[model samples]
Target: MPTDLSPVDDALADALDDERTRQRETLSLVASENYASEAVLAAQGSVLTNKYAEGSPGERYYGGCEHADAVERLAQERARELFGADHANVQPHSGTQANLAAYQALLDSGDTVLSLELRHGGHLSHGQPYTMVDEHFDVVHYGVDPETGRLDYDAVAARATETEPDLIVSGYSAYPRAVDWERMQTIAEDVGAYHVADIAHLTGLVAAGVHPSPVGVADLVTGSTHKTIRAGRGGMILCGEERADAVDTAVMPGCQGGPLMHNVAGKAAGFAEALTPAFDVYARQTVENAAALADRLQTRGFDLVSGGTDVHFALVDLRETHPELTGAAAEAALESVGLVANKQTVPGDHRSATVASGLRIGTPAITTRGFDAAATERLADALVDVLDAPDDEAVRDDARETVAELCRQFPVYDGGAVASA
Candidate 1:
């Protein structure tokens, strides 16, 4: 029972309450989602949202931007400290926007851009045919090694040599292993292209020093603050001092206007939290829990991409073991039992993206709820049971019970009222 909302707009308030209940009672395994802290949430819901600051800190298009300036500066300083970057722009509305601004800053229209194939784990903004980026740029794609389900630097190098793209994009949404940022930088350098690493999915891991940082390696780095960092829903760009002005102008006048000041406050708060020692433990536990879950899933006869994971998530390739099960069906069955996850495309997926051949399971949200390796192992068992007998009501009933018990044991958000059965 939180305050402020129940007194007004009961309809929307009830919906919010229901969502909170759902979050508390279910295991959130989405790779691109995480729960923001109360401090971060408060900051996001603050009155700062009413303000409009159209420019950078200290230099604004409107008056009464002193507080906005302070918040943005704090966010930028904290982000720079966390990622060891000479510059950080905390204004992009989302990770896609951040990447868009980066491209706009570094490359000209019709410039050749090389990025990973979306079906093979890249993001849509990297040059999906339907995106505005594709309409504006000449995009080429590289892919993972089908046999290994991992990137082959030599193959990427060969492609770069042939295409000679103006920009090379790295980082991914469904990749379970760590990226070799230095190798990507070398490839871009050899081809005389700028390297833009989008660590949207691993921002918090990198901030906690659990995953390797691309701050100094890549020519430009962009990420979403909400995914792993648990900040407000927004994006950030980090680069060297040399590229700061270009990125600033691109983000401001080029892609968007009026920075989200409330989100910037949230980013400041979340970054402050990450600077503490407790966040280190949380980040380390997130990886360890994912590994534990993967090990358990593997033992249950599931094939994982790249064999296993080195981060907060694992991509379960079901093409071999459960050829009949599409990722959509698996996702639906799991969701029915309150195990929230997403369908994903494998390296050599034959099915469409909507009904992928793989499932991406993440441990960030569950780990944030104080779930350790043992709890994750139990979750893996429940997930396997549901997937093993997705059409069986008996199996779903049993799995639902297991999930309920797990939720009760590791509740979220001050143990908010559980959703009714």
Candidate 2:
């Protein structure tokens, strides 16, 4: 039985209950989101949160860390096994932090770093102006091929050579195709630059062997635990034995303090789940569902970036299909009908970041709820209906009804129980 939060915090508990109800009823299509399993949730909300293990597993600054150490060790071991890395640091609080520590470990201040442009599917930590990385490093950006909306390795190589960067950052936030890690490695090698592959969005796919792994190919790798991996919110860094000490130190006293042991336990549970054969099936289905979504949307006259997807999401470039419709307008229209997705910047986008020209719809969350290709096609149809008539009250009403029916068919959480705040 779960402890009731109503007695201690009625207001917060009510809000949490409302949020749970929202998730149970809506079709969440956010590309970076996923529904963690109950086991992972329990581990995240466990008692380990109270402890302060300021150092690595076996070398803690505080006492009474036996269980914390054990959990961290298990999480690291599982991560190494899952991604085939020589070492794993499950300490950084988020993917951004993991990238920061990786940069600190590999390069010095003022060293040039070459990475993808933020509007071109790269993360903010990869050298956005607002980040500390930008303040410390000389950052150069490479962009995707405008014709294909895919990374052009030749362009990246040319950019690396032009900048003579100390590090080259690969992997992305919104790209929908498989990356050639080996080719990127070769480019970094030719430029004499260390490669840091930020696989924050494809952690589970790589772990399940559905996507190419960058662990052994890249000089350093980083990822988020919560995105595709179904772990609690956290970050991880993977590196070879030669760089293990530097990466570990950079993650600890270099960027952060005590580790979140409960989240580490959650990572362990999530990685263990990923090791099973069932997870491989889930990973493959995620990609298949995205492909189905792309097909359905393209059939309805929508223009998808790259013409389709090779991963768990599809980027719909709405410029040609709906020139007057901004991504923000489409996002609101879909949300009104219980289909939640985020506005995104497509290649050659002229709009601001807040009002992008594209929509990135993902299948990880819906797939976790047991949605297959057929169900995804239905979802795509409903999404198109809303986008086609965003301001029509009758159309939104019909879409909402369809969403409610689909929610009934595929619920996110069993028993519809909302845990206390």
Candidate 3:
């Protein structure tokens, strides 16, 4: 019943159809994941991928660059407006590389840098020992307050004042609260340090006006396009006009060689879509759905880390649900059902980070699929049902069937109908 297709096109089309099948079949709760739009996909697959421009727009090392100029310039202008930055560099290949480039532009070898500890919700690129930047820079640690489960500005300030660091970073991979940029700026100013706000998780929210922008407060900003922006995987660095040249230079020569032009075009499409008014509603609803899910889990006797959330993610402590359940067992059991999520370590966790005591659930993908509070409530009920009967293969299979039914009803992909397997 299918139309005739060329061999190459048919193979590619089959791959895309398989992708659609996967998205429709699974409930993605990974915080860093999102479904890029059709426009984004087109841009990424555009002819821009053939270019080898090695430098910034208008100053490329290569000779032939008529279209690359337009694509790169459009990306820069849109990013500048969307984030309220004086100038934007659309070149960094990943958020980690973006942070590394910023450090390259600012700090000297072995210069002391301050950031949140990775185990306590910070990213590895933010001075984790495993990253190469650790050897280039002397790293000190900070963390959220034990009582509040949010960034303790006073503690960060005190650390900055005491250490007199070169750069002060305020960002997280797992933090769920909105950052206090003003306080962060103040602390950086007092200690004569440069501030970098990694708003990777909140870029769409900030662009949509659902969350406050962090571009002007910090000297530098780094973001990921996939998390909140609904773009494909890529990184971006934004800076004030004064440092734009240095930032660009650092990202190019200092950190990486060639740029991911395809990803940059995808970022361009994402930025355009984020500037729309409806995205504001979507971003707002993401937080609402997260809050609703967290509340439902709490009412169902799960202990939420930091008690709750103000954003799209929640780190849930599962001791109440199953006192003897290790996070590894919980994750396997939950996955056996269709309620997908990841095991995460909580503060004072008794188990290893890899085998955590809790699971981290996010709302971005389901939110993209149009699952609101009522549907999320059903999700919470499914989780509770699984926990209530941990060993029930029948229950797990039933839950998976239930999830597949929901997925079938609310299919992903631009066609509205999920491609048949």
Candidate 4:
């Protein structure tokens, strides 16, 4: 990494320094974010970034792609081994891209796709309106039971039967309950639909065995490498060998060109780290910390979606408890106190996504920084202080002090970044 950029590019260097400082000072509760290891960072910033390896390993379009091929192959191997998948494609630029490629490989144009409703915890790539997926495919949606705030699989099966979709997309962005992969797969089978499980948020948990894996059960498994996996900032697809070639072609010439070899190296490094026993412990603790945070928030009278989280994050439905406080306002209030989180839409939220009725707080980044349940509970209490009185500066000030103390106790990085002088 370029530690010193002062003499050549002071402006960009200063911005990077500021961002690093922000991360070190604040608490990150974003469900889709995590701190990648130093090894992963180094790999992404290496000379491999200059290479252009267009095709899969052993059949690159570029002439000088031997090392590039090696790194990509390593990433693929590690991803397959880590997830217990028959085939792995570590090339899509993002989780959305992975989903796009999977759809391209499996579904024809205008084929009906059944996915969870975005307002009820599905990703936009899962056929939200105006997106490429929605434009190309006939999209139908299923939603959680509003009364119970949980997915009703029986309802899902009914929806699938009614839609008779060519593809069924499972997994979510903000639902805080465990998914029954087999049940979903069976539903898809009964309808003669292909199952694509987008395990983006649960990648690390699944890899670490803390969450269930959909590698074998789902026809295609897609995920982001950075979320919980702490890998390179990219996307991957896993599938049976029969579908590997189609998946590869769709990702390469089908959607993207020359893979980001540097990111691939990062994926390889992170996956290697994930294979260690410590990652499993971290994964388990992340879920435990989320549960602890949820329990603390619940005791404070915050209504969590589905009652709590089974993974690394919790979705707090603020509609019933604080009817007037919008999720955007809550997010801003928490950010004022140095606690970073995101606004989310609850099962039956009537508001727009930007001003939704929920808060999504996660523990992956905090757990990576060595925080346990006790520390998470304390943070949860601080969050409550901010949410309970968003307009109260005195409360926010107190919460900031608590946040600073916690930052001191658990620093994100060992040392500060060196800025160019």
Off by over 4 Å in 1: 415-421
lDDT of 4 by residue, 3-98 (tens): 568978999898988887888899899989888877888899999989888998889887988888888889999999999999999999999999
List model 1 lDDT by residue over 1-421, tens digit each: 5545766788888888889788888889998888888888889999998999999988999999998999999999999999999999999999999999999999999999999998889999999898989999999999999989899999999999999999999999988889999999999999899999999999999999999999999999999999888888899999999999999999999999999899989999889988888888889999999999999999999999999999999999999999999999999999999999999999888899999999999999998888899999999999999999999999999999999998888877874311110
Q: Which regions of candidate 2 fall more than 4 Å away from where they truly are?
A: 1-3, 416-421
Backbone clash numbers for all candidates listed: 0, 0, 0, 0
TM-score of each: 0.97, 0.97, 0.93, 0.98
Give per-residue CA lDDT, model 2, range 118-169, as digits (tens): 7888889999787899999999999999999999999999988888999999
**Candidate 4 stretches greater than 4 Å from native:** 415-421
Instruction: Please report, as a residue range, the 10-residue window in candidate 3 with the lowest summed lDDT.
Output: 412-421
Winning candidate number (lDDT): 1
Can you write out model 3's per-residue Cα lDDT over 298-348, one digit (the tens) per residue? 898888878898888888777655778877777778777666778877666
Give the Cα error of residue 155 in candidate 1, in Å: 0.3
Compute the lDDT for candidate 2: 0.90
| Minimal lDDT window, size 10, model 4 | 412-421
